[model samples]
Target: MKKLFILFIFLLVCNLQSYSQIIFENGYFINENNQKINCLIENQDWKNNPTGFNYKLDGNQNILAADIKTIKEFGVNGQSKFVRALVKIDRSTTKIETMSREKNPEFNDEKLFLKVLIEGNATLYLYDDGNLRSFFYKNNDSEIKQLVYKMYLVGNYSIAKNNYFREQLFIDFKCETISQKEYENLAYEKKALEKFFIKYNKCNDPNFVSNETKKKKDLFNLTIRPRLNSTSFSTNNSMSDTFDIKFDSNTNVSLGVETEFIFSFNKNKWSIIVEPTYQYYKTEKTKESSVYLGGEVIGKVDYKSIELPIGLRHYFFLNDGFKIFANASFVFDFSSQSKIKFTRNDGSEANSLDIKSGTGFGIGAGCKLKDKYSLEFRYLTGRNLLSNYVTWKSSFATASLILGYSFF
Candidate 1:
């Protein structure tokens, strides 16, 4: 749960919101520590959770959000009395990126109900089905106090790292009144509501608002990457029996697709991109035969990899739909090695998991064209993604031409 807040920011930046705006009502202050804590009362932010208020308040009635609202009613005594309210809309908002021009955006809509009455120096109210809800004199929002409650209900889903802290957002609601009791209920209601949202929101996702919203905003995205990746396997020769081996480094070249999601912060000049893809890579390595084969040369190195490229790219725009960029890619390699031919009697050549994590850095230059496309040339070098007994240095370099599509 706590981890969700951290992931919210990363996922929120993935897309640029094209159309999304929340409707907000009057804002007010919630007295705390002899000071006023100002916040929005009735605001419509994105509600990611499905189980929340239906965005509608009966016209005859009113809805007060986390902030405050005041209403007046004439009592039988002919004196003007006040009906104050405090409404709590408990819902989780998924990641929300303000409307932008680039990607699809979503909004969360929620509605709540409000009503109230005053009595003595306290306020009394109905909590659904006429259940008694009370607030005493000392319960004023200005005073400090603590009261133990019942079972805590967790109604929110964990924030996904990819969802951004944009999810599970909240605001406070309050109302002032001429009726002391009404004010009392309003005060305590506001306090409880605020506490609920804050305590829960923070208890689960500490980064929800603090660190998730501020991130590199991507206004334009371009990805045109064609990768030639292949995997090969070797078996049945060294062990003098039967086995399988897959190596992509030396013997295969399969055309694979590479996709990229890019984000820009400094007016589209500086950006970061995540290229998550499945690539087929081929490699050629010299294999020495042990006592099994006496001494022999291997034919191919083939393997498949799910490559996640985290890149930092800087772009320079020229006149008329033209741009230049120099970017570095850090590759996280997840690969499987098997399905090729290997020694039959060799113990090392037996079935094995070739899982490895390697980091590769690549620098590339790209041009943004009129067709909303990009062409890039890059040189990548890094530690090998393969793990082997012999000296097969991961340090390798490659020059590639990439084509990309720009989305804005």
Candidate 2:
């Protein structure tokens, strides 16, 4: 039945040019251009016509053709490879189909399996009579043959083509059946996508170099320097030491300690510092113009004052948790006490007192430690006015050392 069916298809193709033509036998006469002809008896011995002839089939009839010509056909139904052609004299298809008939005693029914491709890899599956199965063998012609062999073969005949094909097919659909151009283009598209992804966000790209990583860094800081105090004063300018009344600042020891606070934001560091101090002073001197043993002498005066220092600080980090800093400040002093007393040769005692505020500038440098601590030394110079020169001018300066901490 299949051969007869195939033959019929062939004849239809042979006589297609003649729309009204009929074929007589698998190897009989064919009419071109629908032309009517004289009667020729069927099965008449020695009755062959004058035209060149061969017989093929058309429906239930036979095709008798006068000439044989060649043609080439491409994939039919988009699956099988066909570099050869079917006769087009009649301009019709001679379709080919394969199926296992249960009615045929030799029916060894096999099914086509499926497969799918992903990221350059293959996934295989087995199908049986429109259903899935476990037993499959390899066959270059079909996927079922391939899967079966892969499931049971011990030889090279079980190549993964079935597996490869199974991967190409999926869900009762045959994608591998598409033309070769489309398949190659699909693979090319995936490759391009991979390259694009790797270029944009891949960590391993050779050209992707940056210092913009989030990481902890050792940073420079700023701090206050400790304060030091000393005093020097002279009174009553004289040409000779023999005649003089002189009193000088004494016990001029400043009390000092450094206090600092630091802060950090992003890559910048800032600091605030203050060094407050106090000093105690006492002195007495007499100037002589002697008018014969008549003399007046004064007792020492006690003086004390508090100094307030405030400054702004800045720093830059170098390395190894080290930093350099500079600072500037203003100083103010408020005297708490001052008193003086004097006695005369005529039996008289006198008293005098003086006190006032002083102002100044402070400058310094220091190093930062551990991102939190720092130490520094700085010089402070400022003006002071007290007792209207009875204490002389309060011009004094000091160097100090300090320690500080940060909270950032």
Candidate 3:
């Protein structure tokens, strides 16, 4: 089992290295001199707007990195786009003012790579850095302006928000017949903003339309996993016995099928997962002794069970195609058949032991490649398997290394 686990790790490392290159796609960027340079841009599938990017001119090996200050506009085959813009951002404390002692938000103007959300009669852009989100817009290709919003302490203890974007939109696009109630009910979210812009375009020009693609949040995956399991257990048959029967740690290989339901809301950074898997475990141990007339004894245990693990997982993206994840799960194990067989030195069959079902927990960490394959190491500790023998108490634990291929 150890050798197999080591080989799995080796293969995983090799696969990671093989795909560890910047994914260059056909794209173009406008430089500081306003020259449109056709090149291949490294696509990171960024969750947040990037300050800088890598590009290869004419698809050559020579690469160059450019920042917002050096690039005016950039896009990846019209799938993703960004433009350099000077915008005002609200730097507000997430904590309450009583704890942070911050009464006013800091409004600063900075050059940023704003993601283009909609482009038509009126263009909308967004700047997101995980910590803050700000929106920008331009009318008729005019100077870009930031939609103002801030939270401030009002009176002695109350907090109030100044959502200037609502008034700005109503005044700037009054030709669309936007009502006061409509703008007031609008939420400061991506979907709401996109809807308002689409409505605005339809009001101005019936032929104007925007094509927006959203990623799916809910995912179902089926995985076939081959695992190397290290298991241990101990038992004592009699109270007056000088030596207890101990089964030292042993290794076994098992194949399991797992079904996973992933619920992601924060750009796949955090997710709720429920995975149910079926596995079989079998191992044997032999003991030699002079105290008994038989002189030698052998025990074999076999387990067929299904485990349901419900948990939460967090992912850290290494690049566009690879990520590392950690998870903690509460496992409920249901044993379909758990039996132990014993044999004496004379090759006589003894009574078989039956195990009970129980619940446990597991924690694991792993790396995933292109959302298709994953390798993980998990440790499981759980309730003991009680025996009918008067003095025998047997418990089992396992440490497993699993390799899985996901079918979405």
Over the full model, what C-alpha lDDT does candidate 2 score relative to the true structure? 0.39
User: Would you list the rank order by TM-score, best first?
Assistant: 3, 1, 2
For each candidate in turn, the TM-score is: 0.37, 0.34, 0.70
The predicted structure with the larger TM-score, 1 or 2, is: 1
| lDDT (Cα, tens digit) per residue for candidate 1, span 1-408 | 212322432243232121122233233332323343333332222211111221223332354333222211111121111222333322222223321222222222322222222222222222221232322121224321112111221224322222111111211112221223332342235345343333344444455332122334445454545543212233332434222223343322223234444442223456667776665655443445453454544434355666676888765544435655666778776776632323323334533334353677655555667637777655455455434523322333344545666555
Please report the TM-score between candidate 1 and the true structure: 0.37
lDDT of 2 at 3: 31
Which has the better lDDT: candidate 1, or candidate 2? Answer: 2
Alpha-carbon runs more than 4 Å astray in model 2: 1-227, 234-270, 282-301, 340-351, 368-375, 387-396, 399-408
- Which candidate, 2 or 3, would have the higher TM-score against the true structure? 3
lDDT of 1: 0.38
Model 2, range 178-201, lDDT digits (tens) per residue? 445433343212233233223332
Ranking by lDDT: 3, 2, 1
lDDT of each: 0.38, 0.39, 0.73
